[model samples]
Target: MLIQKVRFERSPKLHAMMTEAPYPVNARVVVQGKRGPEVATVRDEAEPMPGDGRYGMILGAASEADLDRWAELGREAEDLKWLLRARARARGLPVKIVAAEFTLDGSLLTVSYSAEERIELGALIQDLRGHTRARINFAAVGPREQAMMLGTLGACGRENCSSHHLQDFAPVSIRMARDQQLPLNPEKLSGPCGRLLCCLQFEHTQYLDLLKDVPRKNARVCHDSSGACGKVVKLHPLEGTVDVLTDAGMMQGVPASELRVLKGEPAPGQQKNRPRD
Candidate 1:
């Protein structure tokens, strides 16, 4: 048995496998998957001598003839996509087909889609089988996975994280944005996946840690040199500054290092925007 990592569109990363032998990168191989004999491209080397009684064996490496057939199927897949969409509309299936993948031998084709909930596509499956004469499998994906599978560009005008380098999705929430003092606008905070931007979670811990040094808005503070009591109207966490509203109604933006606060308040670990007075 040879060890290999194979790529399947349904999976986020390469699926682990113990196949017949090592296949060169880009070489297509047949492997038994949960659905049936599936086609996958050899992506990278894997651990040798892995005990894979649970993993499916690589049916075989593709021959030149099989490669020719694989190319033919690629052309046919496009037509199949249009046919599948038309059939879905006819049957009134509430799903949006995202992508399709076929095995190297063209014996099976997996159709991936996005839907609000589980959908029964038995009739649509039968129609697809009749048109392609191949075993049909259905995979449901979320908005993020749909963007990843289709390699969609995000609101940033760049390829989305899932499609580029992000291998997995981490839960993102509006809290992260608030913690970072970001504006709460949905358009600014959401990505192409219709979810919070993944970048919000990247430095959250650091932001929190930095925030420990900054005095919070609306807290009472004192100036080091002037000894004037003021209410913290804003903080600039990154710049290490605070905007203060003095008892005399004067506004002063001073470095965090120069600001002092009550005993129980946070140390100026970082700066933040001032809160509205």
Candidate 2:
């Protein structure tokens, strides 16, 4: 009934597994993963989770021999990765092999790759099968997943969130950048993956909440300090301020709290003429 979080060396995801006894954090344990018996590190202390049938039980604590074998497998996988790349190049296939992982039992080998378009791997898989006795599987990943697997730094000069802590990619769109009033320049708004920055979703809600109280751009408002009506030129949601063009043709930075939105007023540069009867 005790559940613990564990992470595999080849994956960034945290998987829950049943533990027979308590294990300290960072302790190595062997578990039956989807691929096969694999070594995983204990991410946290075990906790009770009743009726948890989704996870499999941990085989046992990893022995010194198991750790040694794990290291050997890592080196083998690296060699296999290079072999795969060389084979692809020989075949004239336009693909970048990102990673290769072998099951603990050495019965299965999984390879991940990225490409501009879909590619038929029939010949490549056949070639690899001939090179090794292990069953070979190839997976194609998108630009974001490729970047995550590569573990590259993002625009903020920090590790990519997908590689560091994010369990899965969130749906990011241009609306998030626009809501935050960011410049629409693609080069500036994109991450190393050439996609919309994932951090855009982090503070989008806060920006929306702040904008609720601020006047929209080019709206008519009255500055309480001078009782002068002006047209809002820009909004500073983060600072709670708005730049206004006063009726006297002067620009002023006024706090949002001091301005009252004047609805139904004529727009700037428009005349409010009397109607003839």
Q: Give the TM-score of candidate 1.
A: 0.79
Q: In candidate 1, how many Å is residue 236 off?
A: 2.7
Tell me model 1's lDDT, rounded to 2 decimals: 0.77
TM-score per candidate, chains pooled: 0.79, 0.90
Q: Which stretches of model 2 miss by more than 4 angstroms? A: 265-277
> Per-residue CA lDDT of candidate 1, range 61-153, in tens?
867776677678777877787788988988888889888777765777878888887788888788886778777888888888887887877
Q: What shift in Å separates residue 177 of candidate 2 from its native position after superposition?
A: 1.1
Per-candidate clashes come to: 18, 0
* lDDT score of residue 138 within candidate 1: 87
Most TM-score-accurate candidate: 2
Q: With candidate 2 superimposed using the best TM-score fit, by how many Å does residue 11's alpha carbon deviate from the native?
A: 3.8
**lDDT by residue (tens digit), candidate 2, 157-187:** 8888878877778899887786677888999
